[model samples]
Target: MMPKFTHIENDRAKMVDISGKGEVVREATAAGKIFLRPETLKAIREGTVMKGNVLATARVAATLAVKNTASIIPMCHPIPISSISVDFTDCEGYIEAVVVVKMTGRTGVEMEALTGVSVALLTVWDMVKSAEKDAAGQYPVTAITDIRVVEKKKGK
Candidate 1:
């Protein structure tokens, strides 16, 4: 019971203590999409985005985000991540990012996976915003959507 309520102490917030929990293989996959104009997508496909290779930069960003999730999101434990895979798909008017994080720890890595996808999509938006902007200098068609943990597994 106390372990279940570890995050709360004296009406204030606290990090949960997983000191006694057994370590197991944990894996999580998360995905998200970023919508943009057709022209922007074309530029990305052609490797002509002003900021250089969009997918490559986004992949680096996703890996970094996966490694540093605990720093970005408070209350997350700084576990040793063993593997990270970042994949991207270019679709009509959208680009999708899928991130997988694996670790041997007491807690699952769903949060790290989700954070990687979010940052990857955001990095894509950053790299392509110039191309996505309209005459008014506003990103009318640009948006990030459907960020979620697609799968999570433990001890496998």
Candidate 2:
């Protein structure tokens, strides 16, 4: 059978009901890459991105986003997240950020993991926009890719 609340029969957007569902420990992991120009990467490595630590700021932002995921996404339950961890690694021409969110609730925390990765990537873009601006002065594009739930263990 199709999942409930995934569609609107006529114009009503129904939220998923979790009143009878058992609370299970769920975890999700999402990852994204920020491809930057050589110079942009150098600036980040040398600690000169908009006068602050880009990676550190992004990590914090990702954690905050995890906590507020329910508020930003309509119809998602406000799960009590137990932990959120954000990490990044330098990958030649790109920076890869991964966010892991953990929670015990009736609903999954996939959105939280996704939101964390997205916000972290955005934060990196914002901090390096000035350095990576195109000839037309437009902000450099940051793409969010490879977002997925790496693992989830259902409670018995």
Candidate 3:
């Protein structure tokens, strides 16, 4: 049987209690991809997106998102993040955002890492919307996908 949700009690939402848990070194990594036109990828690589540096802006957004995950997520614990790394890679017709978050706290940083990648990809999409839009001002081939946690570790 599936366990009850950790953030629910008496049909009301609540934060998980981690007061009794010991602090440990925790790390998590997440990745996501955004598909776009080949021309758009070239533009991003050449720094000609008309919106300034897309990768740098996305990195900043991802770092901020990782640090603020607890505030944005309803049931997440406010962990002290020790390190965060955000990077982007250009695939054949897509861009991949990878995020890693490390912390020494009672709980893991999986949510933070995932949030980092999500916001990073969203930032990229925002910066390249004009380039990816079709003649009808609609997005045809542009999309965000394959968002998942790639790694998680906990130890002393």
Top-TM-score candidate index: 3
- Across 1-156, the per-residue lDDT of candidate 2 in tens digits comes to 987797766987778999999888888888888888888888888998765999999999999999998899988789899999899999978999889888888888888998999999989988888787788996555455666666655664
TM-score for each predicted model, relative to the true structure: 0.91, 0.87, 0.93
How displaced is residue 49 in candidate 2, in Å?
1.4
Q: In order, what lDDT does every prediction score?
A: 0.93, 0.85, 0.94
Model 3 residue runs over 4 Å out of place are: 1-10
After superposition, the stretches of candidate 2 with alpha carbons farther than 4 Å from their true spots are 1-9, 139-142
| lDDT at residue 67 of model 1 (Cα atoms) | 93
Question: Candidate 3 lDDT, tens digit per residue, 44-137?
Answer: 9999999999999999999999999989998998889999999888899999999999999899999999999999999999999999999999
TM accuracy, model 1: 0.91
Candidate 3 pairs with clashing backbones: none
Clashing pairs in 1: none
In candidate 1, what residue range of length 10 has the lowest lDDT sum?
1-10
